[model samples]
Target: MSSSFDKFQKRRLISSYFSVVLSVFLVLFLLGILGFFIINSKKLADDFKEKIAMTVFFKSEANDSILKAFGGELKTAKFAKSYDYVSKEAAAKQHTDIIGEDFLTFLGENPLQNSFDIHLKADFVINDSIEKIEAGLRKNIMISDIVYDKQLVNLVNNNIKKVSMWILITSIFLTIIAVLLINSSLRLSIHSNRFIIKTMQMVGATKSFIRKPFVMRSVKLGMIGAGLAILALIGVLVYLEVNFPDLGILDDKLLIGIVLIVVFGLGILITWLSTYFATQRFLNLRTDDLY
Candidate 1:
């Protein structure tokens, strides 16, 4: 009878350990997905920012010397990424290419103005900042007009802001839900060991003495789960990199190391927290509640 009881207890312990491991694995998986988005969003936003161009059209009668000085000044500006000076002839040729040969022949002279194609830094693409940049450019005597898609820039900025906020809110909500789910799963796992806890308590085991083994088991389970989740994440990253070379920028070694460290740290923290609380609950349970 004693031998059978010990065997049954061993089976129950194994089952509880597996349950905890499975729950930790799921939590880590969710965390990995969240981390991927948070890591990539900034890069995507930067790429979009780089594409936003501000055109500075020069006066038709602006001399080469004045235009060169203006271009030099623009290069020195803090927000200017780079600038391309388009001469009147070049602009006319581009327009002729679009409209056909006879269009420019009908005109006595080139109607197209010289212009500077300006690329601004990512942070400077915001509406208010662009307004300031436009005002500053208007002060330049050589510039006749500053043209940029105000609506497009504003739309991109607003959409990015909205998406970022949505991601933040969604991540927070999902994290809370995941924690609760993991905690409940751990509670169930602990409840399965209620009889053992009661038996230990009856045998004069202190709360800490009874908690130590369970906590250690939880730590081991969490580590295993975290390792499995990390392997899966690595696989997904490799697949993405292979399939979409454009996303290869996300394969930075330092960033990958940081993600792995976060996953391991989260595993340890969640395991410790859940196990500690579950053990406390078991320790405070009455004999009648053990069943």
Candidate 2:
């Protein structure tokens, strides 16, 4: 009977410790993911902004050198990220490919204009900045007209703002939920020791003396849980690097280090506080209240 009781107690100890660690691990993993998204939000916005292109068409009277010079000037512009010059012939061919017909031959002339497809940097891709860029482009005598999707640019900006705001709200909500869950789990783990706490009280043990072992155990569990979470997060980043190399999220070492620090620090803090409070409650409970 004595041996059976001892084995049961040992099993319960292991089970309680496992439960604490698993709960902390889950919460830490969630916060780590939130941190990753928050850090990469700028990169994502820039990527979407690159889709807004401006095509500047030139008049037939403009010579090749003049048009090329205008393009070179655009390269020096503050708004321009890059530009691709398309000859009239190439534009005509591209149009033909799209329409699936030789419209140039049918009309006995290539009506297409030499154009530059300009991609603006993220800073200058805003709607107001686009007007400034357009005004600057129009000042060039070699340019006939600048064409861009004003509505598309506006839509992209508005949508990106909405999405970013929503993501930030969601991350904050999930972080709160994760903290609560970890706190509750740690409290419950300490709650399981109510009887032991009462027994220690009957033996005239000091509160701190009784609580020290539990607090140290909780801290150890927290460290283990945080280490596991960091390892799991790293595994995910490695997978992304191998399979989705273009994402580039894994390249930011500073952001990765920040995430690891937050997870490790949070795990220890939450576990320590929860353990201390829960043990204090048990220590103060009357014998009948504990029952």
Candidate 3:
């Protein structure tokens, strides 16, 4: 009967620890998902902004040599992400293909002029920055006109700003929830061991001496839970990327690394603090309170 009782108590202890670790893993996994979205949101917005191209038409007098020099200059421009030169003939051909007819035959000559489709970097896509860039581009004598949808630029920026603000707020809210849930789990685990803690205190163990083991054990559980969460998060990302290659969320390796570190850090920090306080609570309780 004595051996059986000892085995039962050991099993109960293992069950309690498993539950605590599982709880931590679930909470941290959800937090990791939010962190990933927050980190990649800006990159997604940038990709959308980069697709809004600005067309720069050149004057008839502007020869290929002048355009080539301008192209070289644009390559080094701070605002420009990329630029593609379209010859008058190429433009005419594209137009004809779009209309499904040879308009050049009827016009008797190609009316289209040389142009460059400039894709600006995300940071320079706003109206004010674009206006400055346009003013600078117009100063070039070879350039005839610059055209882009100003309203569309404004819309994109406005919508992205609203979305980013909401995401930040949501992330903060979810983080608080995760902290509470993890803390509650640790408290419950410590509560189950209250009798043992009181027994240690009665046997003349110092508070620090008694607290050290619980703190260390909780920290180890936290690390294990975090490691499992990280693995699960990575598996989800890999599966998503494999199926939807264009999402590009996994492209920013640095952000992913930061998210993993944050999950692990939060796990260890929250558990250690929670365990310390929880053990301290039991340590201060009266013998009768063990009931």
Which predicted model would earn the best lDDT? Answer: 3
Per-candidate TM-scores read 0.80, 0.94, 0.83
Task: State each candidate's clash count.
Answer: 0, 0, 0
Candidate lDDT (C-alpha), each: 0.84, 0.88, 0.92
Clashes of 1: 0
For model 2, give the 10-residue run with minimal summed lDDT: 67-76
**How many pairs of residues in model 3 come into backbone collision?**
0
Give the runs in model 2 whose Cα sits over 4 Å from its true position.
Answer: none
Candidate 3 segments whose C-alpha is farther than 4 A from its true place: 1-11, 99-109, 236-258
Candidate 1 per-residue lDDT, tens place, 1-291, comes to 999999998998787777777777887887887888788888778778868889888887799898889888887899898889999888888877887774667788778889999989988999889999899889878778998888988888889989999999988997787677667777887888788998999999999999998888778888988888888888888888888888664567788778878987878788888889998998998999877
Give me the runs in candidate 1 sitting further than 4 Å from their true place: 1-19, 88-102, 105-109, 235-259
Residue-level lDDT of model 2, residues 220-275, one tens digit each, is: 99999999999999998899889988889788998899899999998899888888
Choose the strongest candidate by TM-score. 2
State the lDDT at 254 in candidate 3: 89
